[model samples]
Target: MEHFSQTLARAAERKGGEQNLFNLVSAPLPEQQLLAQTDDRCLAIMTKVVFQSGFSWRVIEQKWQGFEDAFWQFDPHKLVLLDDSHIERLMNDTRIVRNGQKIKTVPLNAQFVLDTANDHGSFARFIAQWPVDDITGLWLHLKQHGARLGGNSASFVLRRMGKDTFVLSRDVTAHLIAQGVIDKPVTSKTALKQVQHAFNTWQQQVALPMTQLSQIIGLSVGSNERQV
Candidate 1:
């Protein structure tokens, strides 16, 4: 595998300079800041990402207030108590998207948030305590427990929530393959572990957050229009 320094240099060279490249990278929030998030907000983030999946994000963003109102601002306590009648009503509600399957994930994922918060004091606490080096494990936990959080959905949610994680976007995956981290897209647990190990190795070399490292690798190769 190529050294991370080489990758960083290549990325800097491609993106003007180190200053410009670093400007595009976002750091994860501190543990205290992450722990400060409420369960309702966490559930809200999950619901937004779940709804955005396979759909236009702009449409979701435009209709987000409707979603907030329809789902009671994504209060897990209330959502978990929603009966089938309420779900049926939401399916016909003009406020949010009418997709029955996606609409149903709100209550299901709400239960997931409530359950996790019940055990960990708060859902954010659970996320804050998870080891960044084993981020794939956290992804697995979300995929196994939360609704519609499979694939990169969990990663996107975590990143958006200011957690330290590497998203396996198309460019990131392509860079990983070029670096011999994995031969194809990460699907199985084994492949994910391999990807984690590669990131961990690169992290050891540079001491940068996995998010920035992943972005650097992505910027090293791919379309210039790609954002970090």
Candidate 2:
């Protein structure tokens, strides 16, 4: 395995200099800021991520306002009351994407937000208090408790919500494999644990957040023009 310093050096060299590389790395939000997010916003983000999966993100962004309006601004309390008829109506709604399966995830994930909020005061507070070193645990929690949150969905949601998380993008996974962190893609629990341990080791060496560390590793390889 390569030392994180070597990885940082290679990333800087590829991107022109350390300053340039540093500019691309964004820090996670402060704990208070993350905790300050409303539960409705958390549900909205969950709905957005669910819709964006296997779909064009740009199209989702373009139609986001429509989504916001159609889903009653994604209020968990309101969304949890949606019935089968409501879902059928949304299937034909022109505002948002009409995918039935993805549309149905809205109320399900709303309940997830509500349930988590009930336990932690708010969903944001729950995520904000989750241990960054055990981010995979949080990922599992979302997968187990939320609808359609398996695979990269949970990670993307956490990253989008300003929780410090390392998304296993293609570049990041390739870099990890190249460094012998895992012999293959991280699909199983054992593989994910191994990847977590590696990231934890790197964190001990460098004081950077997991988000930036993952970005640096991603930048060290792959197309230089691609965003981490």
The candidate scoring highest on lDDT is 2
Q: Candidate 1's residue-wise lDDT over 1-228, tens digit each?
A: 988999999889888889999998889998889999999999999988988999999999999999999999988999998889999999889989899998889889999998998899999999999999999999999999999999999999999889999999999999888878899998799999999999999999999998899888878888874434
Pairs in clash, predicted candidate 2: none
Candidate 2, 59-130: lDDT as tens digits? 999999999999999999999999999999999999999999998898999998998899999999999989
TM-score of each: 0.97, 0.97
Model 1 TM-score, 2 decimals: 0.97
Give the Cα error of residue 32 in candidate 2, in Å: 0.8
For every candidate, C-alpha RMSD to the true structure in Å:
1.5, 1.6
* Clashing residue pairs, backbone N/CA/C < 3 A, model 1: none
